[model samples]
Target chain A: MRVRTESILPYSLLAPTLIFITLLIVVPIFQAFLLAFQTADGEFTLTQFEKMIADTSFADALKFTFLLLIFIVPAQVVLALVMALLIHTRFKGHTFFLYIYALPLAISDLAAGIVWLAIFTERGFLNSGLFQLGLLERPFLFLSYQNLPALFSTLIIAESWRATAIVMVILLAGLQVIPRDYFEAADVFGANTLKRTLFVVLPLLRPSLQNALIIRTIFAFQTFAVVLALAGRVIPVLTGEAYNWYALNRNANIAAAYSTLVLIFTVIATVVYFRLLRTSTAEAGFD
Target chain B: MAGIQFQSIRKIFGKTLAANDVSLEIKDGEFMVLLGPSGCGKTTLLRCLAGLERVDGGRVLIGARDVTELAPRDRKIAMVFQSYAVFPHLTVFDNIAFGLQMQSRPRDEIKRRVEDGARLLELSDYLARYPAQLSGGQRQRVAVARAIVMQAAVLLMDEPLSNLDALLRLQMRAELKRLHQEIKATTIYVTHDQVEALSLGDRIAVMQNGRIVQCDAPMNIYDYPANKFVGGFIGTPPMNFLPGVVRVNEGKPIAAVGESHIAPSVALASALIEKNGQPILLGIRPENLALASAQHANTIRARVLVVEPLGSHKLLTVQVGAEISKVSVAPDQRVAPNDDVWLHFDPEKIRWMDAATGDAIHPG
Candidate 1:
């Protein structure tokens, strides 16, 4: 009787949280799916998806999103790993350094993009510093059409700087859970710094790395605010393109289709990431 | 195998001295145990030998190598931690093979060595299993296998069997002794358990307050402790210390504990000469005290406070004046709480110490 009541207590306690999640996540997701299949006349149709695929902006948006992911993912992972290692070393003022590194976590993505824009703008800090140093004859046009590489670099840097803290925190937590004895044992076994980091620390940190990868990849797919703050309507990303189609052009049907596509891409990316993690991590016996 | 030596090694953590000017020589292929209470610097000394801890002063040498400033990787030593410290992510085979792999030994050689260690430890079937999947004893065995496969000159084990259950600990203790005998490596084992130190070590070093109080064979330490601390630490039920007045009666020394007095043994009488009329502690082993029917010479009459029945022997706690001393008797001996008994001890088995300094006054 006690066991049965104990089992029921959890369900009763979790009922409120379950209801809240259903209202917040499940309701909106179901509405989005409903909207995706509905026509302008409120009739069920596949025409919106067909029209969405035929739009040239959709292809360009897809290409730009992939490019952003390609640039940001590796940079963010590497930076987060370095930051985690630095914090793990317990140097002087390490807490202060960690706080400084994690300060960007509280800043809005749009605000970070605007901050980067101030540096990368034609009349911004970079050009003024160069002019003061006499490195440039005049203010360099960093965000100009001729400098596409500079624009891409600025976008990648802004995203990486803003988002790497979450991964760093996760990796730090992973590092904290690894027993000090493991490191001492490694030391006893004659493992040097590089070998210890690569063989012991990396293998143990696999679970955190996998979780960080999946979360960052999903967030990368839906990246919008930074691109909008940096280039506004000049540069089109997937979410920005969808916003333009739905709110500016007044095409709810095609916008829903674009939203559905982003959702599909997110699911696919998450599945692929987890599948890769499952295979490699299982082979490594990381769990 | 290497003979280990610590030459005035000291470790200070901030203002506190964890290990202070500790110096000792451990003979090659000798199983020397550093036995002490917790936080008495036994582990610190072990870590110093392994180079895991940096000494604030003096040098540490293994077989003539001045490894005082060397990193642990350069020290050529293997340590089994109290936690066993098995790599959780690695299989037992991989965990055992870790040291060899880190050294970048040939793959076939690593495989053969790990397999050989596993077979020796009876962990051959569990090689593919991870540490979490194995029992505590299995994990501890894997830790030993890992250290053994290193073929290092010195094996530093810090309470390696402390985490196991009592039965498992006893079994593993025997296994460890056998393994040591087979390997014949210079092993420095650390434990607070006197029984373990006495049974397993060739020579036991009893430490207190960062200094070695005594370093000798276990039986010698038991029979003749250099100081009160070693005498108190090395015995089970602990050597009982009774405050008594020493006096010279007809030019013969006698220790007076409460109303009863006993003649001093020759070994104790000479040391008590300087301590005449001074308050001293009389050290007697519980096992040394025998129950008698009548008042034997050097016997005290007391009422039993408690009776603890061990399978082989019974422990009787008797109140002699203000002090209570425990006496061990055969389990077959009929003794009960509240029973009046006469406790007799041989003078030859008694140890005398200065109460002020807690140092052995007799056998000096």
Candidate 2:
């Protein structure tokens, strides 16, 4: 059999990335598995798993993580799609709106959490504004443990505001790649704007939507700083619990166990999104 | 089918006059071709009629209604784009049925119309196939089928065959002409290819710089163009031009070329009589120039420069003073390069145009 240099050259070029991934990702995942299952004396043990299951906040963390995704993903998807469509309209000042819509993508998740922390503080803008407008008689305690709904609502809003921009940018790229003739053809065919968006834009935007959903869901499961900054342990999410176990309790084994749980949950959510949004190859004209 | 009337239609794009005071009336069921080179606003005028482009001035009437401000959907027109903008995601049947569905037609009616269109365009077998699975010719047929299935008041084709290969273009051109005859819909076709324009258009509207220079029957435009640009633009190998001054000899108008003088044809001579001492452009087609056996009244003595042998006929390039004129000779007629020949211009075939304005000096 003859070997070609062209075929082997690509693999050689990919060698550095393969090595880095093996060292940084593959080795760490293996070490995490070992740490979760074994004791410091190197004996196989179920001690960390028992502790993880018995932790008082474990069920709350898992449930709240899923709840956050349920709240944030749909809201962000709707907001991003609307923003993308507005930009696609190319009205006057659309460029200005495009820059403003994508501005939140530049802010880090920690910074975004801190930014919203200022808004939801007891004497922050919301409470002061409500009091000045006579909507309230006094400043409200928004992030208190007793105000769980307000705390959760504020977290959802902050996450949606900070993260929807990435999805909007993705959808905007997808919208721009669609040839203008399709829309013109639809118009000449007597399709109203709503029908055009439903039958033309959304179906064509399926791949981008799938990608955005999967990424957002995975990140939603790992949400930490925003919940921490706003609620201060009042809200328990998966990554927050993992941070508490490692940073506060100083237990590496339990932290690794929590991390594994987050990973598993992310993978499951990603799979569910794939199954729900999958475009059949035949329908996409691949066949 | 409905007729189209554009009264002083004007369109401006930024600083460019895309369609400038253009007026045309296309009869119902007539195939009118807007013919010009690129950037001459032929497509812009077609887009205006389709209501895709908003005219800055004047009125557009389709049938009896004014449609200048109406949306493209309300204009009751279907357009086939140059790129064959058939929806890629839809099957052939669904693509053909799209316009009807938009109109909220009954399901059975839509199905019957789509099936009929598929049969007409020979696309019945490919009804279930997506556009990506079809060949270029099939995709174009699907586009045409979609347009005709709408049964629009007018059909607009913007260089629909420009994307196909040579053989496919020829085949589709004939198919389109047949389709027009079968459907009998008023179609405004736009093309830059003179052959397509001349072959397909019942009336060819030649445009230049956003203005319709001449609109007339294809044969009339071919035989007697209204201006020098039309004359040079219409025919294959183009009409040959010779610069000459009009002079009187024995009370007759003679086109004087340096040391040689040929009397203008009677019809042309009358138009040139009053314009004596002014330069005129003498226009003749290549086929109109014949080999003169001996010295004749309207013959110019010249030397053959190059011989281009086509399959059926040979083209002889002859030098008449400083200008070179092509004369088509029969294949059997032996001719070689650099041979002295006396070429006679058919009297009735000569065209006299004003040199400055380029307009034909037609005899009253």
Candidate 3:
């Protein structure tokens, strides 16, 4: 068969992306797998995994990571859904509210972390405000290692404030595609607001919920910048342990093991989300 | 089960007046159709009745109870939307049972009602299917079934047939009439379609801008339209209108044409005698005017412009002086374009409209 110029043109156009992915992404991931399984002399061994399991913060990292994932994902999803629905109502000055809600999307994770850190630190705005309000005689240490739950909560709030906008945007798109007649039908059929939200709105929003869940969960699994900036070593996460192993201790193999574990968790999370928020092709707008 | 009254209803949407002091009474089991073109407030009026729209001022009564301040869910009304808003995620049975479930009815009663509704809508076989699995007509049936299962006091439909194809629309229109006959719910249906209004409405309420122009039975609305706008809006191959003068010729009231004049009957002359040489609009339906064999006292000369051969009849577009008029003629009528013709007025069928206000003036 003769290769047609038209077909050749398509592959030529695709070459740049294919080459870039193979070199930058595919090659690095392959090297990470190899490094995770190799010893210092480049010989294959299980020593990295053994070392990763033996590390003091490894179990803490996994537990805290799961804790953050369990708490933050639901908080962001609920918050974003509410914001999206409120915006969809098109009330007076809804555009202004939408703008305010999406403003944090442009913020870097580190920037958001630092910003929240200032508010949660001992002499930060929250403690200062509490002192001024006569609720506290002095600044309170809200981000101390003595209280892990407090530290965990600050991480969840800061992360949610930074990341919920993307999910809301996805949900807003989903909401817009839903015809206004459905809500009117619900009202006419005597479905109250809560019932309508539970039955009509949520069912229609499955594809978006699926997407938001997978993306946010994967982001939770891989997140390190915000965690480090806010909680540091006190609330050690998987990615932070990986970072500490690779950059501080100069151990790429152990870091690769931690990273490989993060990948596994992300894959598991994505699969779980796909199962939980499953939408038929019909509901996903295919038919 | 109950009647509806919109007592001096007024609704304002931002700067646009959607319903301007619209007051109407709909009897129990009466199928009242609010008929008008888009932006004429027909749908707005229906929404206000269904409690979907808030009236800035006025009261809405379902039977004797005032429901103007009620929420839509509390209004005891069910509606079928134009888009056939069947819950896409739900099975046909579940969709139909939604309202019954909302009412917290017994499970068995909900099942019985849904099954009955499905059978009524011919959706019994597709109870397990989702809306996406059904055709447009079937989905609309699901919407109808959903409404019917509730058995509310009032059933409001907002252009429900508008989304269907032409053949499906015709099919649904007949089915809706049949359903109304069987159920006898006090229904308020809104549409821009005149045929639906004429066929389905017990009383057709023709609206314009934000006011009801006329409300009457279908035939009465078609045969005796209250205004020129109502007449024109409700018919095809519309009423022929000529701007002419009512003059007294030989002491008899005659409408002056280009050079000739057509005199009214002896009965009509008595009514027009009071106002001589008054400018009036002479209106007649195409079917009411005939091609005269020769020029007579009741005939005006014209030239045939176009002869469109319809299956049942030939429609002749003729030029009368500077004005054009449509005349429905026998299909075998030997008339060609540019042929000279004389139009004979059916004196009894002529409608005289006020030249300025467009209101019907039944002279005699």
Cα lDDT, model 2, residue B318: 89
Candidate 1 CAPRI assessment class: acceptable
lDDT of 3 by residue, B98-120 (tens): 99998999999999999999999
Using DockQ, rank the candidates from best to worst.
Answer: 3, 2, 1
Could you give the candidate ranking by lDDT, starting with the highest?
A: 3, 2, 1
TM-score of each candidate?
Answer: 0.95, 0.93, 0.93
- The two-chain DockQ for each candidate, comma-separated, is 0.49, 0.52, 0.56
Q: Which ten residues in a row have the lowest lDDT in candidate 2 chain A?
A: A278-287
Maximum-lDDT candidate: 3
Clashing pairs in 3: none
> In CAPRI terms, where does candidate 2 land?
medium
Locate the minimum summed-lDDT window of 10 residues in model 3 chain B: B262-271
What local lDDT score does residue A287 receive in model 2, on the 0 to 100 scale?
81
Predicted model with the maximum TM-score:
1
Off by over 4 Å in 1: A1-20, A279-287
Q: For candidate 1, write residues B63-145 as lDDT tens digits.
A: 99999999998999988999999988788889999999999999999999999999989999998887877889998999999
| lDDT for B208 (candidate 3) | 95
lDDT of 2 by residue, A9-88 (tens): 89999999999999999999989889888999989998998999899998888889889999999999999999999999
lDDT of 1 by residue, A203-271 (tens): 888888888888888878888888877666555678888888988989876787888888998899888
